[model samples]
Target: MAQFTFEGDFEILADPQIKLVESALQKKGFTNGKIVVEPVGQKGDNYIAHVKRFIYEAEDGTTFNMIGKVAPVAEQLRLMMNTMVLFNNEIVMYNLVLPKLNDIQNSAGVTDDEKVRFPACYGVVTEEPYEFILIEDLKEAGFEMLDKMKPLTNESVRLIVKDLAKYHSLSYVLKNSEPEIYESYSNKLSNLWAIVGAEPEAQQFFESGENDLFKMMHDVSDQYKNVVRGSLTQITPIAKKIQSYEKGSKYSVIQQGDCWNNNILFRLEEGKPVDDVMIDYQLSSEGNPAADLLYLIFNCTDHATRLEHYQEWIDYYNETLDHSLNLHGLKANHIFPKDQLDADLKRYGKQMVNLGVLLSSMLERESKDALDMRVMTGDKEKLWENTMAQMNASLLDISTIVKIRQRIMGIIDTALEFGLI
Candidate 1:
């Protein structure tokens, strides 16, 4: 028998992780072959996990492909990103929550076309320090993520919110039908922001970003800038309230906590979106639908596009939610009414503005300035010493500063206009 070979970026993985992947392959009857695993997407596309695509070839000319997401190796990076908590939450999402949700949809006789799309977990390894999740590669199935730098078109926006309605509605379904099971998983998922809020580094990191944020506001009018300055005080408190277990409200559903362009993949037909698959549930948790709505809108689309269709998108999401609820003989008006939904939006909008600035900073980084894989992979003492130091306004180039300001300020303008701020 020929020995198995691991190639490319797969070499970075430790022995235990590589063995786990080999074991997973053996379980699929793929033994003794060339297994090539390489990093996925470009640098800075994702900051939290080290994602890679694994390819296997057999002598009979068969091919198997999948994606593996491993916890970042560096202890400093782990602390900075709340890596362990986020990884475990996603493991729960795939291994427990999503499967049950899909079964509920199937038992209701909902067609595959209408069900929430998620990649299948081929296997998972959580032994000690070597933790990784292997999932079906959406790229092999013809799904592609939109570019982070580009604004989503109106068509893309509609499909996203439309599908988002299906995804969020199921949480309500699971809650009503199987409250025990719902609570079991929801309770286990940790709130990343809430966890970080208690840390000493959190304040300094946020303040560093806030300083850069104001510097970017140089070209903005005094009226809007002051409105933003006033809202700053509410940010820390709002971050705590979001995904808050103590204050969990009736309107909260399991939201796709990171609902931006890159976290969702689209299957396009001739440049038009036909369907989408939800990815990156690392930050997903029991949260308000309004938070998801605001995230999708403010982070994915710019101010001009939103100024044209902001109200329309909200209306459409509510309508789609109502339609999806009817699947299980339930009523959205009874469970999550339009009035309640609108109230939640107003409640969460300010914090959305704060997070929008953070997202834009990551999205607009040029390739040269993109996250250095080495730093993330390196382990060193004094982990928290440089928290958010790189984002210092004086350290950034004029071009990047302008881009971050414009993207974030655009979100602010839309929020203020919609009365969300």
Candidate 2:
């Protein structure tokens, strides 16, 4: 509170959470400075946590910046979002998993340019309700999140999967090199959907959304609707199967888990891809590596792009994964063979496409219609306990519906063509 200027209502951070930030800043050598706190990104861009940018104007005129994923102050929303599990998963990734991964690459003398790039964690506070992850701001390095509604270009997709392969290689390294340590992380990450499936309230929330999705499919033929249902309605059970400890653990790697456009940030140089980093690990879980590719390919790119490069992207990811493993003296065939990867894709492909359909709705929502967020906020919940009246309003937009429809059907088409479904 001394020299900190809260740009908005985030001044609510006057609690012990503020002290955590102050301590991290002070440790970084900013003994005397003004810290400006403000929110980052739009409503639809992020939902689980409030992403805030903290800028410290040091006495010497150089400003230091950090990004904080802060829990909402509203307890009702906190319970609904289950920040307890989500934030704890992230804190462990930053505090435990990623550091171990960095050590493996460093010991191998991997160059910084070739290693998996993640933001440096300054501090992590997993104290319930007040949980937040404080890390270096990627924006300082010119990294930015792509537009959620648009398709990622082939070049951009290459940069994404290339980094994904490298990051996943570390997972295999940690698993083979230090099995005990890797198992600990695998045990720690809770399956978000498995938890949702257990809670009646959470189940209702998704069931409502699922109902709307089925309504959208009313326009399609029964053959295609069955294809849609193969994954869509079975979401919870399929996710449980994938995230469960027994599911393909031999071939599993620490997947980005929720691999979508919004969770990845790219640094563009003159309108083309240069470097990119994956952010938001709340859903990070141990699963078949194929889950990441299927999720990203279906959810991030358009049908046209996937048709031209779907098989190529999978091969590219395999090549890159093998190369990353080779850098540290591990062999992909010895650990995750190409045949196994293809089998995993066939096994998990439809379930992952189901994820694309669900994410497509939320991520593709027009800015003006993203107000379903109101249902999550306590204040809005208080006013509208019976909000079914406005439930499908956003999903009703013609253009938004088209995007969602195309993604759903196109996802199925590609899977069918590849013999995955």
Candidate 3:
């Protein structure tokens, strides 16, 4: 085994180049420490190197445990300047949001409780080619990552909705309170979906895949063709809107650009759901709160359960949103009125539909391995194997599918009522 050592503060861990990172850490007050990289997790585009526990003695002869994260050069380069910008934004969010959350807890007059909505941020450091973030290790907190295809319990769904409401409420409050900072950071988000939709090759792949999804869409309801077609056509345009902020929407919040179950961590108290924690602020930006809601509901939940509890879930989310906003000295009608939320839900429903198509490619039973590997290596057999494995894992009960179809139909009917198609 090989060991790496660094000096200075722990923030210099972000540099892609190891030597510079070591020098920066040394400068920042982390001398007399050893660094060891361990494989913890990997996504399609990025790999995480977990810096194992470190021992630091205080003046009272007490030792504290700390950890760090480092990314490979390729992943570091993908976002380029955008990566650094996101890092800085997260640092600001941590400093601002974390403290305000504490204040909210003490005020008693506060609307939303901040026990476990956001991750515990130790600190963040960014230095050019190397960027490192020190965060409370989630694994150490007794939370386990759920499999991508596993169905969430009804309680899990409710908790997720509650946390999302609080998250959106916070962003809306921040936007009104600090427009300059919100606008500056929110403007940098990249809409990769729109970009891919524009590419000829990507379009072809989606067009072919659309037929399969259409089959699934039609099996659920007769009216979905037009809805699907319209959504598919609007993919590029919606992508553009997502790329920039829309005018006249009074309420704005930092959108958890990616809000799948995989990105969430849950803390269970005595086997009952107690708290939910959100991660991956890399995709955080200002956008419609409904976008995150739709994303999570459509992508993470099972087709059957979602369809069965769709209406209830929506209502619950609204209630949560209202409650959260009220705590921040705001009202749901002021931020997202019933009529506005419905309209946004319909318009944004199309975006979710478009996203569903993209997500299905990676989420369906046959696509599991590809997703696990975090890459599309153009291997059809592997894709099919992974997809089937997911399907098997999901069990795909007939009753579940039928119920899901009916629920999906209800959503389509609502969209039709709103003239979204």
Candidate 4:
């Protein structure tokens, strides 16, 4: 009913082509349609356009709404490899994993309610080098992005932990029940972190912030050198441990490889948070669940609030695991005893040290006036001034150096508890 202007460099289909597509739909039983393109949103190199509800004057005048995604040729080409990787992952999930699981369910004759934990896939269009997918637009479906730095309510935390447990449990079952499939998926998850770590850009980024972060972790290094020595001695082993986990018979389901808040979508039903849908599976592959949990906590929660609620969140994760395992006819004790889980929590928790340093550098706030603060292309002196100004503002609270120190000390304490250092 409402029309809006759409602007982008994406190739717009001609009126004739639009008519052909519409006619094709009409022949397939759709009717009374008018196409209006509405600008949706843009991220990185892609743009989303919406084809709103079509009103049909015939056959009860039902309205049908669909979405279309388009992007510039250059942008599409730039991200082609990344896009292909995600598409391949989706195909594997749909073709190899979902069907097998469904078959198993049918053979067992289990009538219990089982929901597929993924976005509804309508179809994909792949013509030549351009590829686009029509998917259920979660933004239009009443889902709000979770804000970083805001501590989640106990209820919301519970739901997240519960969903994670179920996800991990499913992966565990598939790993043992179908080893070949599990191995196939597992092989896809190579050490991507190693590649990133080896990059010169990464080295420069780390070097830029190392001195400030080192001062923050100074206390921990001083107080618990004996304990954290191992963690400090080898970044490679730490990187590997942070990437993979070893649980009895269960192989890791793809770690939501990137566990930042923005990558997760929370769905609320009846005024209560009920579900979490993880997106951007490009980096996903076999990994430790603890790494995901720790990464999310460090990146999403403010450092000032984390220590206060850390234990409670851990307990919530355990409770979710217990419930999910019971539903799947598995027991938590059989997979990870209470003692072992605690130990892993402590040991693997040191991985948060690397993550904390990374988050501090990346999440520092910059004002619009600080235009020269852009990390990629700004002049070095101007960017340094802007970064220092931002750090100074943070320092007025307790000094930027002190905050970094505190985070490092926190990591040391965790490492000591886990006997990792």
Per-model TM-score versus the true fold: 0.93, 0.93, 0.69, 0.65
Tens-place lDDT per residue, model 4, 80-115, is 223344445444543355445545544545444433
Better of 1 and 3 by TM-score: 1
What RMSD does each model have against the real structure? 2.3, 2.5, 7.0, 7.3
lDDT of 1: 0.79
User: What's the CA error at residue 118 for candidate 2, in Å?
Assistant: 0.8
lDDT of 3 at 106: 44
Could you give candidate 2's per-residue lDDT for residues 78-118 as a string of tens digits?
66666788888899899999888989988999998898898
Lowest-sum lDDT 10-residue window in model 2: 380-389
Q: Which stretches of candidate 1 lie over 4 Å from their true place?
A: 1-3, 227-234, 244-248, 377-382, 385-387
lDDT (C-alpha) at residue 22 in model 1: 82
Candidate maximizing lDDT: 1
lDDT of 3 by residue, 136-229 (tens): 5566677756666566777888888888877676667666766775666565544445454564544544555555445556644456666666
In model 1, residue pairs whose N, Cα or C atoms come closer than 3 Å (at least 3 residues apart or on different chains), thus clashing, are: none
Give the Å error, residue 207, model 3: 4.8
Q: Give the C-alpha lDDT of model 2.
A: 0.78
